[model samples]
Target: MKGFSAFLGKEVKEQLRNYKFLILGIVFAIVGLLSPLSSKFLPVLLESLVDDNITILLEDPTYIDSWIQFFSNTNQISIIVLLLLFSPILSKEYEKGSLVHMVTKGLSRQSIVLAKGTLLFFCWTVAYWMSGLITWGYTHYYFSDSTAEGLFLPLFSLYSFGLLLLAVLLLGAVLFNSAFVPLLTVGGFVIVSFLADIVPVIHEWNPLQLATRNTEILVLQEGDRLLAQAMGVSYFICIGLVILSIVIFRRKNIA
Candidate 1:
């Protein structure tokens, strides 16, 4: 327990010293502010660009539009930022051969991987949800008629999906020596999940559904059984990936 605590502390310090948290907070803050601001003012921005003689018909924006921008930005750009920021986590240690010192000093590889993953997960969850909360608060303030039902389910599901991504990154970082390995692994998984979306049977089981089908869950009058099922599967996959990463790292020849 002492070793694990030290490792966790070291991971947190590295994140702070390297400015990972600062970068994540800045990116998420921008996304949070932009989503709602865009929802409220996009029509005016579009109108300003129109030809003088032409008038474009535009409906008043709703809270849903704010959420639409929120999910779109978060699921696309915010997540990509997370992946890129964390891709080097393990790769950098391996590349510099700094992990050798830790491994030889009796710092278990399992603890290192677990500590890093836990720290990253904690940081990502805070940033991700802080962005969403700010957007929600602003959207609600601007749009009085909007009420999001079953909001917790979707938000929790999205958070879980992010953890699953981090787990896969740990596995990829362990399996390959290059810094590009994590990015390539994540991208390939995304592509495979995209393909899975088209398959009728696999759609419900795929983790991709957690991100993509969120709007559907939000819009529908009732919750989705498949969302719940996918959440369960994703949670299990995250645990499995973390364990696999530990096993892989245990056997890796660091010398």
Candidate 2:
């Protein structure tokens, strides 16, 4: 426990020194700010671009529109940024030959993987909630009459999906040496999951649905059971990946 805590502290400092926190903070904050602002002004912006002779009718943007922007931005750009930021996590340690010294100094390989995962998960949680809170606050202010329903389930599902992605990245890092390998692994998994979504038999239980269908879950009450199933599957997969990462890292030759 002490070793794990020490390594976790080191991971946190490394993230701060490397400006990971700064970059993620800025990106997610921008996403939060843009979601509500775009939803509120997009129609007006489009209307102004039209010639006086042309008439364009757009429905009044609502809180749902703000959430749509939120989900779209987080599901796409935010996840990409997260992947790029952390892709080199283990690879860089390998390249620098740092893990060898750390292990020799009495740190366990399991501790290293666990510490990295813990810190990354904490950072993601903070950034994700910051973005969501900003969106929530702005959405409420702009759409005062809007009432939020079924909010917690979708938010929880999205957060779980993010954790699952991080776990997969960790497993990829352990299984492959190159930084790009992990990125490709994670990307390929996502692509395959998306393609699998087209199959009716797998659609309801798909992990990708946790991310792609977040807005639907928030708005519709009918899909509650399916969303619960997806969330459960995602969390289970995340745990499995973390365990696999530990097992693979144990057998991996760092020297």
Candidate 3:
């Protein structure tokens, strides 16, 4: 137990030392500030492009617009940032023989895997929630009278989706020795999800619903079933992937 804590502390320190925290903070903060700002201002920006003779019919934007921006920006940029930031988690250490040094010093394999996973998961949660909460605060502030329902549902769904991705990436990191392997693994999942969506029968069951239907959830109540299904499937897969990581890491040859 003590060894776990000590290794966890080392992982946190190494993450901070590598500036992952700074990158996470900056990226999420940008998304937070910009999501609402873009939602409110984009119409005006688009309107300004019109000539005097042309009139564009613009429906008054609602709170749903803000959330649309939030989920869109998150699903697109946030996932990419997370993949890039964590891509090196295992590969970097393997490249530099960092784990080999610690393992030689009597560090347990389980402790090392747990510590890295803990720190990575914490960073993902903090960055994601900070962006989300900030966007929520600004959305309400900027559009006080506008209402978008099911705000919490999409937020939780997005956060959980991130956790699922993190779990998959961890498994890829443990199973393969290259940083690019996790990126490819995540990309493959994304492609598969896209394909799943095209089949009408599987579309509603897709975990991609968490990120894709966020705005719809705000406007309509019907998507809640899809959200729940996504949450369940994603959580199940995430846990399975984490367990797989642990099992694979235990058997890995670090030499």
Best by TM-score: 2
> What CA RMSD would you report for each candidate?
1.4, 1.3, 1.8
Q: What is the TM-score of candidate 2?
A: 0.96
Candidate 1 collision pairs: none
Candidate 1, which segments miss by more than 4 Å at Cα?
Answer: none
TM-score of 3: 0.93
Lowest-sum lDDT 10-residue window in model 2: 219-228
Task: Please identify which of the two predictions, 2 or 3, would achieve the higher TM-score against the true structure.
Answer: 2
Per residue, candidate 2 scores C-alpha lDDT tens digits across 29-114 of 99998999999999989988999999988888989889889989998888889989998889988988999999999999999999
Clashes of 1: 0
Q: Report, for all candidates in order, the number of backbone clashes.
A: 0, 0, 0
lDDT of 1 by residue, 1-255 (tens): 676789899888888899988999999999998998999999999999999899899999988888889889988889889988888888778778888998788888888888888877888889999998898889888889778676766677677888888888888988988887888998888788898789877887877778887677777745567877788889999999999989989999776
Evaluate all candidate structures by whole-model CA lDDT and list the values in order.
0.85, 0.87, 0.83
Q: What is the C-alpha lDDT profile of model 3 across 162-248, one tens digit per residue?
A: 888888888888988998998899889889989889998788677888777766776764455667888888899888888878888
Pairwise TM-score winner, candidates 1 and 2: 2
TM-score on alpha carbons, each prediction = 0.95, 0.96, 0.93
Q: Would you list the rank order by lDDT, best first?
A: 2, 1, 3
Q: Tell me which residue pairs clash in candidate 3.
A: none
